[model samples]
Target: MAEAVARTSYGRLVARLARRWGDLSRAEDALSDAFERALRSWPGSGLPDQPEAWLLKTAHRRLIDGARQSGVQARAEPEIERLLDELTERDDPDALPDERLGLMLACAHPDLDPTLHTPLMLQAVLGLDAARIGAAFLISPAAMGQRLSRGKARLRERGARFDLPGKDELAARITPVLDAIYAAYGTGWDEIGASESRVRGLVGEALYLSRLLTELAPEIADVWGLYALIAHCEARTPARRDAEGRFIPLSEQDPQLWDAALISQAENALRRSLKLAPPARYALEASIQSVHAERRVTAETNWLAAAALYDAMIRHAPSLGALTARACAHGEAFGAERALDSLEKLQGQASEYQPYWAALAHWSARAGRREDAARAYDRAIVLSADPAVRVYLVKSRGALLR
Candidate 1:
């Protein structure tokens, strides 16, 4: 229970401190000291009535002590005292604003390098370590660490405040913010755990953050669309693995295990997004997922409809993942041969991409090109980092050889 609370509340605590101190690194250091104190005191004194508030109060004192030790100017002492007074006066921990949203906006600031936005957000908001984020971004751990350090340094040097953007500036920052949320969700989605609980925790954090964003910006169509998209995918969580803990492909997943409530929520969110103006990429993707979700009642996939939606999505988004999904949809709607032809056009471009090889293997197998299928599967298995996915690919290749 302590671990769970720590996972969920750490970001909020850090965000609150970062806002108050106006120094992300210093805030983190103070919090780290507070946690160490908790580790030692909690085991002896028993758990505090309110762990979060206890941590906050401890962190507040640590910050002040550090300031004094560093010989902070007398001019700032009164301000620090005021902050301390406020902390002491607050009885309800729940009253604290979820400053994590503001921190996310700060991480995705337009002034920062665009490429660093998602990685920095993942680290600062979700507490993902550099190695995990490095895997997501396909960078070396050393490089990822250096990049994160540099991004934080830049924010400090620029005196970037941990605050949400004003109405006038909010629109421009929306894309990066949304992208960072999805990137976090994707990391959770692909994670392979000994049990589903670990994966669920990360995915749940991402969903929580997305929901928070929607509440903050309810009028944004893409925000609703993103919420719907994640909800739709999350609805299928139970069916993604079997009783024996092996991975199950979407097509083979038992519909009965899907979460009906989540699907309903997804549908409602998608409807709300559709009511708004200008269709966005996320909305289009949600629409596609909606069609898949329909199989729960209809007992069949509408491949033709999905193919059309993918075509539209490609026109609007044009991502490699979208293109790969489109090819799979085409294979279902049209035929494996045509899908192979389309995938061939992307050969050199997507050669190193795991999904590309996996798709090629599937299509080749369907087209009766046994040798090509085996080769493609071999490549996919070699490139896949997720143990479950790698195992699945190996089993698939073995079946092909048999």
Candidate 2:
């Protein structure tokens, strides 16, 4: 129960506190202190009827105490007192306006280094520690920690506000926000049903943020596209694994188990996005997923259509992940030899990329290069972070040996 509440509420709680205090670091520290107090006190006192309220009051007091101790309260005492009074007047514990979306936008503020936007969002808005964000980005935790600290300092020095941008300024800031949300979703999607609850929480949080973005910026085509992409992927979650908890590749998933409502909602959003603008990366990606979703009704996967979408995606984004996915799609639509050629060109560039190894393993097996397939699978299993993915790779390699 504590774990679930922490997972669901921690980000929002921190974001609200940060907004009120105008100090992200202090907000985090106060909330951490409050949670620790709860852990120590809740066992004997029994759980409070309003845990979030209790947390907020405790964290607010901690912030007030800290400010007084630092002697900074002299100038800000009136504002601080007002905020405390506002908190006390709230009837519903969870009724705080979701400030996380605002915090996310602030983290992706254009004033900061562009490269740090997604990392900062992952840390500040999603509650991922620097170490976890570093692992995702293939950076050392120390480097990520320094980067986050520097980013926060820059925001503070510039007096960044935790408010959504105006319409005139929003477009310039949209890309980083979209990227951060996509990164969050990808992290969760990789670990679904893999016995990692924290990672799984990212799925819901990403979806929540995406939905909020769509509502906040209804006219933005990519917002709808991103939501559609996430929805399409999520629609297949019900059939992603079997009773034994083994991974089920998309092709082998039971279509009957797919959620019809989510698929309908995804298609609606995809259509709306396509109607609004020329293709963007998110729309293109959603189009590819839309094609995959069609397999349930058509009784056949459209490899050629998917390959075409991948080609478009690569031309637009040119990411290593996109290239690797395109190689697999090309293999499905063309032949193993052609896919192998594409994968070979990426050998040096994508050496550290897990999907590259996984793609190589699959294409190599299809091309009847058993030894090469085994070697690639070994590399892939070693690099994969998700235990389920590692197990699946191991099983694939065993099949080749047999």
Candidate 3:
């Protein structure tokens, strides 16, 4: 019960506490203390009838205690007095005002480093640890941890407002919020774990944030396009692994297992985004998914359409991922030799990237370069973390040996 509350309500609780205490770092510390106490006490006392409320109350007390110990109680008296009054008036924890959006915006404040915005939001709003977030951003865990700590300190120093930005400021702040959520979703997509947080992952959390963004910023085309992209990817998740749990790449997945309703929702979202403006990076990516989704009814993948969408997306945001994807799509639509040539050009830039090597292996095999294919497969397998993907790669490499 305590664990579940922490997972679902951590952000809401932290947001409220930070708003009351006027300190993000302190709020997090107090909440962490509350959770630790709960773990020790709950096992003995059974359980609190209102776990979230109990947590909020306990953390609030901790904040007051900390303030008094630090000899700042007099200076913090006004905020404390306001908090005391508000706590008296609010009986239900569920009625606690949700300030998560404001908190997210503050984490993405204009004055902070733009690059740190997403990482900060991932840590503060989502409760993702630095190691996980660092993996997503390709930063060292220690470096990411230092960056997040510095971000919070910067927020405190700047006295970043914990309120919704004005209409004019909304557009400027939202991009990083979207980026953070997408990064979390990507982390969830590739990972499978035994821990509760890991097993639950950020996929559902990301989807919730995506839906909230659409409701909050209906005019933003990128917001809707991102939603469509995530939904389309999620719709096909059930087919990404076989019954035996081996990895199944997208092209070979059984469309019958795909969620029709999710596909429909994604298509509607894509339409809404395209109607608002021309196709951008995410919109083009969603269009590629839409083309892949057509195989459900059409029973044939249109590599040509997918290739064209990839080409357009590269023009908009020539990210390494997009470039690598373009090479794959172009190879499928054109020829394996052409794909190998394109991937070769990315050699120095993509030397450490696992997907590049994986794609190289695939194209190498198709191009009848057995030795090069085997070598690429070896590199891909070494770089891969997922057991299922490693298994699949091993199988693919074994076939080449035959």
Candidate 4:
């Protein structure tokens, strides 16, 4: 029962209640109260045969009671009332389960402030904590307490329709929605270091949105590109961190730990993306990931091939970040000398980060250019304070001495 409800969309649940009760505010309050009651009552009752229905009934009662007490007439839309009655009659919670997730997407629409939209989605759709949301946004935990309510009210004021958008309309909004999913994955992938639980939460959320979007818009290449990129990237999740909970670079990671299932799916998606009229960043990144993933050994990696991919990547999406990735790819494909040449092109790109210098230092030391490696390492040491990176520099300097 818990699993069923867990799989079901809380977004749909809230939207249904609001639509039926004719008051979003009242619907949310009643739902919260019902959930609280469920927690208190479930353990003693040994769980319900139909927990979702039970919760819905409890929320319904709360809504009716609150409406009567407040002297508010039942002013629900005629269509909404009809839908509510139909929902009331349906014995199966699974009948329209996917609607819940759709509600989540609608609530997180671009019309809302990005900062507030994510929090509201986390709360109403994902059931995330205020503290977590606050940390994700780098704010006071208390600030998130009413953010969902406020965001929802703003949505209500704008008459945000709960119904899913038409195909073209949905495709128009795909960019932000897809960005949200990618942001979630990065969140999860970076979590132990930043917002750990949230990182996982966002990964699941991304996949959920991907599945939802692809199902609705099967012909959309961007959506397929997103799913492919994520699928490719997630294959390395297990190898990303070690059993000791330390970061492992892709080159040094234990390839044995990668999830083959994700790789297989990624390959299929990559093919699908390639067949589309034009390739985008997602498709390009997925191809790059595939190159690394298909390698038999670190030495066997097609760095030159990867460099070419990154070169194309920068053209598709030019940024400092892209420059950095391309620089690393050059280091892999060409000799340290050529890679250093490539990186030198970005002398002032990120004067603060020094990824180029540090990488150049490692490459120089490995290529037996002690003096050059030491100089590059010194530059990196001055610019960056990351302990692991410092260790890498120190180790490079040591290797030069050896």
Q: lDDT tens digits, residues 7-52, model 4?
A: 4545566766765544456667777787788777877887776576
Q: Please, what are the lDDT tens digits per residue for candidate 3 over residues 186-300?
A: 6434222112234235667677778777876888888899999889888987997788877888878899899999999999999999999898877888899899899999999
Provide the lDDT at 292 for model 2: 85
What would the per-residue lDDT of candidate 2 be over residues 1-402, giving only the tens digit for each residue? 455567677878888887877778888789888888888888899888878878888998898888888887568878877876887788887677777767887888778887888788777766778888776666799999999999988988888787666775776668789987887775534322233344454677578778778876778888899999998888888887788877877878888899899989888888888888887999999999899888899988899999999999988899878888888889999999989999999998977788789889989999999999999999988888667778888999999968
lDDT of 3 at 79: 72
Where does candidate 3 clash, by residue pair? Answer: none
Instruction: Return the clash pairs for model 4, or none.
Output: 187-199, 188-199
Query: How far off is model 4, as Cα RMSD?
Result: 4.1
For candidate 1, the per-residue lDDT at 96 reads 78
Q: Kindly provide the TM-score of model 1 when superposed on the true structure, using C-alpha atoms.
A: 0.84
lDDT of 4 at 221: 78
Candidates' C-alpha lDDT: 0.81, 0.81, 0.81, 0.67
In model 4, which range of ten residues has the least summed lDDT?
187-196
- Backbone clash count for every predicted candidate, in the order shown: 0, 0, 0, 2
Q: Which candidate, 1 or 2, has the higher TM-score?
A: 1
RMSD in angstroms, candidate 1?
A: 3.8
List of clashing residue pairs for candidate 1: none
lDDT of 1 by residue, 13-95 (tens): 98998898888777777777887888878888988776888888788888888888888745677887787678667777777
